[model samples]
Target: MVAALLAAVSVAADPATTASAGEQGAWFSDPVVVSGQNTAEPGIEVAPDGRLYVNAPAGLLADLPGAASFLWRSDDGGATWVLTPPGLRAAFPGGGDSDVAVDPQGATVYFSDLWVGSSTAAVSDDRGNSWFASPLSGVVIHDRQWLATSGGGVVYLAYNQIPAGVMVSKSVDGGRTFVVHSLAASVLDRSGCVCPPGTMVVEEGTGPAGLADRVGVVYATSTGGVGFARSVDGGLTFAQVTVAPARDGIDTTRAFPVVANAGPGQLVAVWQEVVEGQRTRVQFSGSADWGRSWSDPQVVVDAGTPLFPWVDANGGGKVGVSLYHTDQATLPDAAPDDAVWFERYLESLDGGQTFSPLVTVDPTPVKTGPICTQGAACAQDRELLDFQAVAIDTDGLALLTWARSIDNVADTEIRFARQLTDEATTAAPTLHLHDAVGDAITRPLPWLFRTATWSPTGR
Candidate 1:
């Protein structure tokens, strides 16, 4: 143990801290924003020690630059971060899109990187300290999904570059190699985009507390309908299940799914579905026997237009979820349909059989400026916005990080709300943090694709 340390430094609340005493959901005191670096891509992870470790991409990190273009770790968790000696950036010269993953035991860490213009992989052994770059034999240009590692094993999600199908690969003897397999094994091309085969998409992880496939599921949309597939053999193979069965010739796209494996065979999955000209709904489905069958789809958000369905790793045998939506109807892609919406930062207290709606993740008065539909020019809009990650504070309190930024620069400050809610039951529906916070996070960091993990396995 390094004895958990923080050097002596001056501390004061920056005046930009906003406090709302009258709002129904505001319980923020004097919260502070921890400023970050400009170059490294920032993402937070909770270590086995129950502290936050923030991974930042290459270039002599402000604190630490463990590996190459990859990420670093923080012993004091996110409170204080550092860079290790050998890094992920040094390992993968073909670096492109990089993602972080922790072992099932939480004792090891993994960094997954993509090759530029393609779907190649390079991974880290340590928590970002060092890594090895291995060519994933047959894989061409697939996208990176949630990365998982257990002891020397490695698993990942990827989509076909053409037909837009889903695929997953695994390296049983660590990330040195892989066994590739196609998921959602359906033959569906794009919606008339004369492209080659299409690729699949993946999501963040829910650790061991999450469902069978962890947090990765493959959904394919075709002239037929949208179908679902999940991997249990560490992503080496997948079994299909229909998420949105064919009804209207309408198709399903962007079906983000997350699961929680309650027990040996009990699993639960949730995803979002859109009806072209109608509403998008978030629904929950469960299976008591490992992917053998699923429960009747329960519409979690039936009254509103759902946009996203995200899940968090709930500590005590549960999973947390965030649902984003709007009730005020607007024509598809219409103007100013914008509104500060509410969400249920829910937790499956009984492992998916029940839920508790917690406080709103996104703050009130709106988080960021309206969506910029101007395409390429939208990235140029620098504006003050809100952004934060969820942290488990106490037994009943969840820490929601809230901050503001403008022009991708720090215009305001960051603040967090300590949500005091009942952990035993489903919390109430609250707001989600979707109003594009800072342009910085969404900004592209081409140089960061090479960083790795920083734990002991880097050796």
Candidate 2:
């Protein structure tokens, strides 16, 4: 019965061809709800085999014994998905935060879950069929943990160690166990904002000679800036550098910065900064020489207040960023009744040199109420959670997954939007939604299944 229920919940949607009024370019397929259970703070990654893996707090499945989080796998790109529960919550049953990472060869997939004072990294060798868990050491308190993998058996995990700043752990035996490698940042360097480290990446050392594979991470700095820490010696020691300096009125406590490796030593970082205490804007800076030097920060989007900025790059200067955006100039707490928030995306074909105009990935409003930035302490309306994720797929198109609030009910579900390419429009894949037991689910179609004319724009 449980398997049938899970199978019944699996759903797939055809790409909507007609662009809405405000959605002029129609660069992305219409948003599709991928999770039937309540889940938020989604993390996404595209495997080498073109499979999409997403992890989030188990939500409704929290009561299931040992169920830490839900791993949603999409074998047919983003059209259909299947949920696999990772029963890795022996220590902390109530899952806190979760992240997903795929190794280079796509043979090993890593999912890290955070508990109250500890965390677990679960490894799946056969995709998401089964997973073995391993505890992460080197941190007294674990908050938000992120995983990154390189060639060989190397895996790096970074998380917030509370007042002690961000700490990193390394796994040499294919994530079987992790040992403390080094501190990405100490308390002295940060402003005491228990902000978790942003998306971590392993540069494959394809740059200049003598440049070994470098592991890099970005975090909030003490002076409302973005601090980057990189280790070339395999996490033994790290050198920290400032990608962006302090801005006078910017708030570092809520500003989380994210970094992505464009190619070799080329890196790009993006963060949100409050302006005049009224609104927030997204800004980005690029580093051509690893983390040693950074370009002056430039505004990526200034029309409205943006939150939870995430950046991902796919080599050769191709970069993508996703964020929760609202046209209201006021903070989320002060949003008016008509204020609506949507998932907005921007692309850069030439690294961070220039960005395309902001494209609304989803026509649906993700949230309509005050979005509390206070983590874990918020009393109401915290459904959207901390961040949404964007990953460049094997086809070099953007794939985005985020949480959408359910009619201001304080509950949220995962939604996915895929960038539409010329090939995708001509040959739309048949939709296939399945249940946990791999049974197909058939249902009446909606407008999402309707076909219309769509032209590739600005690709």
| TM-scores for the candidates | 0.62, 0.83
> lDDT for each of the candidates?
0.40, 0.71
Best by TM-score: 2
What alpha-carbon RMSD in Å does predicted model 2 have with respect to the real structure? 12.5
Please give the lDDT score at residue 114 for candidate 2: 69
Clashing residue pair totals per candidate (backbone < 3 A): 69, 2
lDDT (Cα, tens digit) per residue for candidate 1, span 46-70: 5555544443333222222123443
* Model 1's TM-score against the true structure: 0.62
Top lDDT model: 2
Question: Which ten contiguous residues of candidate 2 have the minimum total lDDT?
Answer: 1-10
